[model samples]
Target: MIRRLIFAFISIAISITIASSIKAAETIRPNVLFIAMDDLNDWIGCMGGHPQTITPNLDRLAKSGVLFTNAHCAAPACNPSRISVFSGIAPNVSGVYANNQVLREVLPDVELLPKSFSKNGYRSTGSGKMLHYIIDAQSWDDYFPEPASEMPIPHTLYPDKRPVSLPRAGPWQYVETDWGALETTDQEFGGDFTVSQWVSEQLAQKHDNPFFLACGIYRPHEPWFVPAKYFEPFPLESILIPPGYKEDDLADLPPEGQRQGPNRYFAHIQKQGQWKHAIQSYLASIHFADAMLGRVLDALDNSEYADNTIVVLWSDHGWHLGEKQHWQKYTAWRVCTRIPLMIRVPKNCPGLPEGTSSGICNQPVNLVSLAPTLFDLCGLPPSKVHDGPSLTPLLKDVDGQWPHVSVTCLHNPGDYGLSDNRWRYIHYANGDEELYDIAADRYEWNNLAADPKYADKLAELRAKGPTSFASKPEPSIQSLNKLTWVTLGDDKAPPSRPDGSQFPVFFINQSEAPVKLYWVDRMGQPKFYEEIQPTKTARQATRPGAIWQITNLQDKPLGYFKVDDRSAQAIIPAH
Candidate 1:
């Protein structure tokens, strides 16, 4: 009887210990809501970019949290830029060289930010352009209601009528009047409504587990679409043009460095005949994005998860408005690379004091820090492969020392890199170089590359860049008339075929001659055998691999490729 009594007492003690452990886990882990905007610059009301550009929702968010003023992107383009943030690796290290590369190919084993939360027992979900082209379905437990949109209709329905070509002049480009109205919306003629509505529903639903929700807004991107109401606020007459450019601004720069293309920023502004209209459109889109943000924030405030959730709002990269004669990203200029980053931690956390007002962190931070920071904020283990340190310390104290700098890579893959908070350096594949003191010349009006005194500083930065994986291996020409290739110039191929097999094939062809071909996999990489010659078939293999097979081919690609055989596909040119 004594033994039985002792066993009962031991079992009761074990139960109590187990319960305490579970409670500890629940209390330590905080939920997260990550909000990412597309092509947004430091134009918010809090940032003081413009007087009429009202971002009340984001302004209030800044009041409640910490803002990073000098944040920049690893790559200014969409695919590589977003991949760097999600993978916590720089574009060079990840091998995501450009917009055409698939992130799964570059960092196949790396656990994404959302995937980390899902693994830690949180209900991970996302909507809209959170992960570039499509939100990796595997990263989230729930991908539904479909990604949110800023327009009412599909993007494919709207096409720019202008001839397709690179622009020649700096900071000018033409935009069609109908370009902004091609998409459909939920309410107020914008698609942000759908994302807001979806987030509201998730907030209302009672869940037993903590949640990680990522909301991505597509507005303020190209085509600058918004409702008529938003346009009303920024009339053409009231819109202020950015500082004017001088003819000799970039005179000392090389011909290669000078702007080249008909559709470049200067051409757009000149052809449009109204630079103010273009600026107005961009501002209107920003305002609409802000309003949508307000809806999501309101939902969070009223929801049961309010006090427990951590909010992070960031942009993929900044946009240029006639600065340095550039309209889009892909440059290292402050107008093109610097983005708006805000973080709102719940009051329960031991970071900043409650209701913090307009705190600005001047340290240079990059999107690469987002993955590790999110993990740290949620009390998760730091990712072993991340290149960025968590900004949690800086958030608590605005004046904290975050001595690190950000780097952005432009054309020529690894060539033409820029390090933040210092001079901008551009190195060509041909060994030519250009340098600028960003602090002294915000507009990049002067070139200091030829200055012998600064040559050592330029060399130091060049030494720090990634040399091993600078460029991927070019694709191989195959016999089966099929081509094998890799994106971002890498030789690595996808692990599995479309049919879930180990074998895969890639194909590419000249645009002048159209031909159909069958590809086969051999020794992991695609080896092509001629299935049909160019004489008979009208359809041509536009790219060397399956992944490239799906991308729109008329535009320039980063030379990555893959193969798909689940179904026979045709490569058609854009009309």
Candidate 2:
């Protein structure tokens, strides 16, 4: 009888253990597939802004998810805008004031979105451009480098190209057209191929671990290169020109408010009177990107992960195709500031009704809110320091009154703008201000800043302060040139040590004046210094082809040194 009781007790214990394990297995974390597009505007069929553009895959995704129609970027430039989204910190606060500003310098201790996920045992992987011009290697567990050439073929076949050129300011270069038989699909186009393939492999692995995969598409940014097949859909003659520009349109804009200039491709079109052809190229590029997106979505559907994966599709910022005579971003116009954002949560997630789609929410939303929103969705703790608020409540109820304002900042000169539900107010550093009822003047052709009736409204917006409101901490000077000795040769010849354990650093003379040397970690963190000089008694340490940057006062490149080989090199100007 005692033996019988022991057997029954053992069986009960085993059952309890099994039950606990089963309950743990059932608690699966939802995976995230973050896809970002460059310079994509409200041209997709899902947005209903462009009539002919067919983004069926995106449309389907939106139908299954919540689409935020009024999404804007904290900054319109590539680096600042992307930094804002990824870091959840405002550009002004983060000190990422411009394209060249490194994010790690401002938030050294802050873990990036992917890094945070990785820390919590989620597998984080990405390919192509995500962070900025420079990818932060420390953020991702795996990163596939972008291809060197962003072309369908090696080079253009037609040498004597007769493309038109438009009058513009800023860096616009021209190139002749070259055709080749290397007709690869947009999926296999250089950098895109690696990203698409990586995503496919990740899905195929079907690991028990949850994954965070981000694919950054670089098309629709410049050159507008895509397969002829995609181009065939948008015939040159049928391509609609953007709303016509009138000379009086500039009447309301300040001198600085005028459109900058056209890019090389648009300039070529204007010179050759092939504006329709240029538009066709752009549309073709967008179509190609959309098709790439479709391939990934199809892969998701085929995989077991589809039902549980949360898909978020966002564009870094919008583009301007001759809207108000501008051909690129970096403007306060709707075509430049307004971006497309779509979030498709898992069907089983709370709040959203299955297959329910919400119409446009005209309330202002910025990309800076993306980090917090993702964290809230994934049930992660958000960082205490972020400029954006989560839109989870709004997603739960479409009519929820989650009213907030969005502000976009332009760098040093301090031109900034504020957008409420109905109006947009822009203020420049020179004390010039403009106000427009965006509901009525989406084009911003009429400025009400000078009107006496709207003085209160202007004050309300301008009271928010300059775009660059955050003050940067003073840089540390002592840690600028401090170095530790590293081994030179593989031989065990008593590792050479520098005097006072400090290594001698050399500065390349790229400029007529002396250079400033700063030390940054692999994560793109910056340490500023007044100047660095080689100590007479200090021995230079040998390191790999990394570890140094030499720059002039204006922050122009001077040279770099390979730490492993102790070799120095100079940077030459590209003619």
Candidate 3:
């Protein structure tokens, strides 16, 4: 009788200890490790999209968390997709439907994703292509290598013959097309690899509170240039035309669907016989991106906070490799809309069961859902409104019965696609429609909109799309007045005009806020040359030893620097 009593007491004590540990975990806020890959498609090894796709890091990450196989971007292009993900606002509502549209002007009131974390006492730091080439000054506590650009590298492999010196193709929008191997090491290429190293260094350090650390990788996007070592694995002979490529996929009924317009990128590759070489380059870039990911993941796993950090890796949107006769992501097809998304919740997180550390989710979900989902997982106060549903349910149960559907657009609301588990419905701006049973036709080879039997089903999915599209917002006049620059640095700086030529001056806005520069004209009077906005530069004729004042939009003096003979030929810090 005494032995039984003693055993019962020990059991009760163990229960009490577990309860106390759970209570303690509830009070501990977790850190966030967010990673983003640029222009990546579902060609990773985990997705099983391509046989030769080698992405061991991405595949391992998928196994470590719930990999959402059917995830889609809120928008297809870079600016809109990124804006939708960060701002928690859909392109239809914000009217930020295209690139070159400044996000601050479109959705000025929305609190960005990182800012919400900062509001809740978390330190947010990020590096490289995180914000689609523009940094949100109010969001981050600090950023590495400030003044972010689209590409981190100063030059590509072939800098001289940009846009490919080859003949015309696909409106030749930007000279972004073309690829080759560089005779250099990964350290020598040093764009995304540097970003990974910086992020890794942060993970190694200790922080006072929770953190939101972001690492952005820009590769495999275009000009697919990586070290020659990455190219060796994918031999030129083994490189085959993408499996999705069809001989004449664009022979369809709808005007919008048949609208190949000016895109000869596919034709250009075929004519130049560089299709296999291009494929090899893309695969090499993907491998390089995967290698960089390995570095970041290694740092996180070896960090002091390894057990308390939530890791998430996502791509902005997928690219097309001659799929449906499309080149880059601007379509509503399954290939263009789908992206790889993985989230690994830490064991120390409160209320989470931590059952099955790795699971796969196949339900269609929107990337815009990320903003609200992070807020939910971090135990922060929810936003006033998020355009999409949260993925908390799917996170808890990979096969959870989620009624939500995914929607994505190209450049406008009407030009969008609505996708669910079994169907893909596209409604273009010109009143053309296309429907496909995704389960039957994975390649989207046939359009089913003409079938009368599926009309009722089409109507149901169409109702889930945007109700009414908002008008595209116009650029502010201040935004339109772009600044022009001239160079002025010290010492080695060119001699200030002894021959009556004005000094070549650089006038870039070095502040987070917009400012105007004023200098004494030839008449010895202070006059406004131009209002230099943030990230904009303007140059004006000024005499040597002339003083220039930079003031905020409200005309408050921020700082002043002089352009003299010694400083004239030198870069001036105009903060």
Candidate 4:
């Protein structure tokens, strides 16, 4: 009896130890919900970027967590900014200055953000336009659609008569600058709505692994095509001009800032008398994006993992609407580089009981620190490659004196803006400079760099820029077949393929630069093949359904090549 009692006690102790270990592991492995937005600046309701913007969802989200009002992206373009966020490498070192360069082509073996989470046993899944393109499959465990497509929504919803490509009133803006409501249901509008729905379903369902759920909302970008009902909230007359606009803002600007400004796009909009209408479209798209955010937030609220998930929301870059007389996001101004960044750590989380506040963090931070911050939060091994400082300290204390200043770039060769808490100093490649003290000159109307009083501050900020930039590598072209055009919604290709297949389609990239090829297979589906080096002949068995799309990395079409039964190797014109 004594021996049996001793055995029973040992068994009980072992079971208790096992249960405790399991509970501890579960508590430490918190899930992450990463929300990404495209071309969305501080125009949300909370940031007061626009006077009449409606963004209750984003506002509520900020209240639920810590909001960083002074965050900036490393680069002002989508591709480079996002790459910097994921890779923890700045654009100056990576040399991915443009949207055309493939991330894999630029940094072959760099550790991506999602891959880091995945390494720590987190299941990373995403939907919609997370990256500039949908080609990096190994980074995420699963995507909404296949690995190659941007989103699951088909590319047939664009209005047939939309004057997007209509003879431009001026040569200032591209065809993508036009905007109007599609007059369709949210489901019919597709893209972001579908992406949100899929993400919501995933959140509600149970997963075997701790998840990193990413939802990318692509709107308020360009070709702002939300439903007409969204437009109803913001009538053209109700739309207000940008609040910080100054008529002569560019007068005191440096030559670089001057050249980037006064773009003909805003001038063209005024010339065509569509300034208010364009603003209305932008507001409507922002509202629609907020609705999508609401859907995801609601799903999370009702989800079982609500108490354990860390939610983070950010935009890739900001947009310009007559601010500095600019329209796109290629410039280095605050209107282009300043992005919305918010973080909500769950209650009873490890190292943080009830976590940090729903308060504002005013310290200047860069999006490049996102990866390193996430690693620290999850207790994962930190990376040594990140250039930006982690905000873990500021999250705990909102008013902590942060010594970091954000570095934002425009193009190559050190054309950048170094923004601290009180000042924004811009340096051009041609040795021109522009400085704005944000505390005194909130609108950046006055340039203070040339003033001798601020010379010490000017020299301090100028010393922070990268001493050298990595030279751009070999150029590659993007393919331009129906598959590629489908993602872009380019209506250049015909609705159907030509008759008579059973021919050989020969491809030769005439230019010295490498190119990409996109083609329809025997199964009649769109597929992408990227970074095909130049001087190689790829032959396709041309049947009745065979079609090809070919283009360089810079989006210059090499030529139009087709195959038919009458020819063995057909090379079409490069029109």
Cα lDDT of model 4 by residue, 83-166, tens digit: 998898888888878765678888889988889999989999988777886537878888877866643333425778757522
Cα deviation of 303 in candidate 1 (Å)? 1.5
Worst 10 residues of 1 by lDDT: 164-173
Cand. 3 TM to true fold: 0.78
The regions of model 4 sitting more than 4 angstroms off are 1-26, 150-156, 164-172, 348-354, 478-575
Error of 2 at 29 (Å): 1.5
Model 2 lDDT per residue over 1-575, tens place:
99999999999999999998875545446788999888888888877656667677778777777777777888888888888888898766776656645566666777788888898778888776687755676777776653332221222222133232233221122232212112555444555545676777778786766888988876666656666678777766787876533435666677667534333444545665756666677777787778778778888989989887888888888877766666667776666777788787765443232422544455778889988887877767778977798877767765678668887877644676678778898777677777998778766778898899999988887775544467543323222333233322332212221112222343333234555554544564435544643331122343333344555567654443334322223221211
Model 3 RMSD in angstroms: 10.4
lDDT measured at residue 395 in model 2 versus the true structure, 0 to 100: 72
lDDT value for model 4? 0.78
Error of 4 at 113 (Å): 1.5
After superposition of all CA atoms, the RMSD between model 4 and the true structure is 9.8
Q: Global lDDT of each model?
A: 0.65, 0.65, 0.77, 0.78
Cα-based lDDT at residue 287, candidate 1 = 88
RMSD list, candidates in order: 11.1, 11.8, 10.4, 9.8
Residue 297's C-alpha lDDT in candidate 1?
92
Estimate candidate 3's alpha-carbon lDDT, on a 0 to 1 scale. Answer: 0.77
